[model samples]
Target: MSAKDRIAVFPSRMAQTIMKARLKGAQKGHSLLKKKSDALQMRFRMILKKIVDTKSLMGDVMKEASFSLAEAKFTSGDFNAIVLQNVTKAQIKVKCKKDNVAGVTLPVFESYQDGSDVHELAGLARGGQQLAKLKKSYARAIQLLVDLASLQTSFITLDEVIKITNRRVNALEHVVIPKIENTLMYIISELDEMEREEFFRLKKIQEKKKKIKAAEEQLKQTRRAMGIDVDNDGPNLFAEQHDEDLLF
Candidate 1:
């Protein structure tokens, strides 16, 4: 195997156990990441759909608001002063909260009117009716704008999170998991080789032992056939057997 494929492990059962544990951990991590990626993808699609719908509504609201402004300008003969007089500290307040989606936190914005109505005396004189219409149109436009902003922010956040999640999933599936499996295979192969080597060494030792035992038994038979007494003690048996064979 190439150096890159080889795992730096001692050829032992302990290393095999460690590698198995690592493989299990890696698989668990891959499963969790895959789930996270799927969730983020689902959220991303929902946010994208919301953005599309909000943009369409925003376009219509903006067009209506623009036409109302034009009508108000024509009827009130340039009511810039009146409009400026009503302008005060912002009454519409936007508050943000965090939403958790698939382990990702996203900011959610909500807008509400915080103070007294500013349009109470907006059309007190001249084109009161037209001024009222303009104010309503602009209010709708502002509401739509806020909605669109929230959707846009969510869309962007989901996009980034989806991208990051996908990268992690791919890395685990392609790189980390494969490397771990390769290392595991390598360890198993080394262990098997070591076992086979040990078995072969044992077989050779057994064969040598059997040959020596057969030779000693044959010598004992020959000593007995030559009318020489044999003993259980190996050294004495060998000496007496040798002396009798030499005399014959």
Candidate 2:
């Protein structure tokens, strides 16, 4: 592979060790993100189911509320203004909470009611039972609406979360992990090449040492064959001179 394709690091055993560790970490991260994506996708499907069911129920609840309102107005003669006048504060409220699923935080909307009565439902009930029925029907409709909204919101949020998580998983699986592994291979190859070169160099040095030792041994053998001391003898100036008295 081209040098640019692999990561640039000093080619050494230490660098190889680090790259192996990085590869392991990448693999681990990929596995975890894959699990997270699967979990988020499961939750996404559940929310989608809830949204469909809630929407279907919404139509019925709203229709019932409309019929109840009509019945209440016919029985009590349009008492909306009277009920509004008595209202001081809202009784039913929506409280928001967070739910964690597969490391993702999801928003949960809950409907709640205060301890006090809702407006003048009791006094209005005295006019006719239809007003109380209307109250219950509309409350049911409102709760359904809140539930639908919560489901839709969670659905959208989870979709985005799942997309992001899947992207990360794909990156690690296809890109990051491969790059690290390739770099590790490169480091290992470089280290192997270095070792081979070192071995060759050591072999050459030993060969040269052996040649030098053999040359010295041959020189000493030649000196002993000529009856010259190899180490202790020095040059004798008159050793080759013919003696005059011996010649007469």
Candidate 3:
């Protein structure tokens, strides 16, 4: 490899060991990410189904409400319009509580219709049956909007959250995890090569030391046989006689 392409500093043995541990941790994290993605996807599908169904029902509810309002309009004064005026801006207090799903909250709303002190003339009709039907239809429409609005909002929120979560999971599964693994493999391979080189170097040094010690012993034996005093660096007649008497 070119100098510029190669790594400037090699990792120590400890670093390679740490990388192996990190690889294992990354694998575990990848599995958890997969589970999270699956769960969010499942939730998305369910919410999508609900939104479709609710919309379909909402259309029918609106149609029935329109027809009912028209009937009431023909029978009596503009009572339908007045009821709408009173109800549209009415209080719709909602209390939110989170469910098991992540990033999702359920909205509980207070009923807007007033029945206790409401004037019967407010939902006036041609007859008692017609008046009752009009009131019932109006209530039905209000309830539908309440139910549909809450569910639709939740569906939209879930869709956004799921999109973000899936992106992260894909990054971990397809990009981040792979990069970490590649780095770990490279570190391990380099560390192995360094270990082998160090082992060979130590072996050569040990052999050289052994050879020098052997040569020194042989020289000492030769000096004694020749009646030379190696340490004193001199030959002596008395030493020669002493060497002859000494055991090998």
lDDT rank order: 2, 1, 3
Runs of candidate 2 with Cα error greater than 4 angstroms are: 118-127, 231-248
The best candidate by TM-score is 1
Query: Could you tell which candidate, 1 or 3, scores higher by TM-score?
Result: 1
Q: Is candidate 2 or candidate 3 better by lDDT?
A: 2
Local distance difference test values of all predictions, in order? 0.82, 0.85, 0.67
Indicate the worst ten consecutive residues by lDDT in candidate 3.
1-10
**Residues 1-248 of candidate 1: C-alpha lDDT, one tens digit per residue:** 66486467776788878878888998899899888888888888888888888888888888988998898888878878855787878888888888998788888888889988877776667778888888788888888788778878888888887888788889878877787788878878888998999999999999987888898799989999998888754465432243445654
* TM-scores, one per candidate: 0.88, 0.83, 0.73
Q: Model 2 — which ten-residue stretch has the worst lDDT? A: 118-127
- Expressed as tens digits, the lDDT of each residue in 87-160 for candidate 3 is 64434333445555643453433346433534455543354455667667767777777666766666677677
How much lDDT does candidate 1 score?
0.82
- The candidate that wins on lDDT is 2
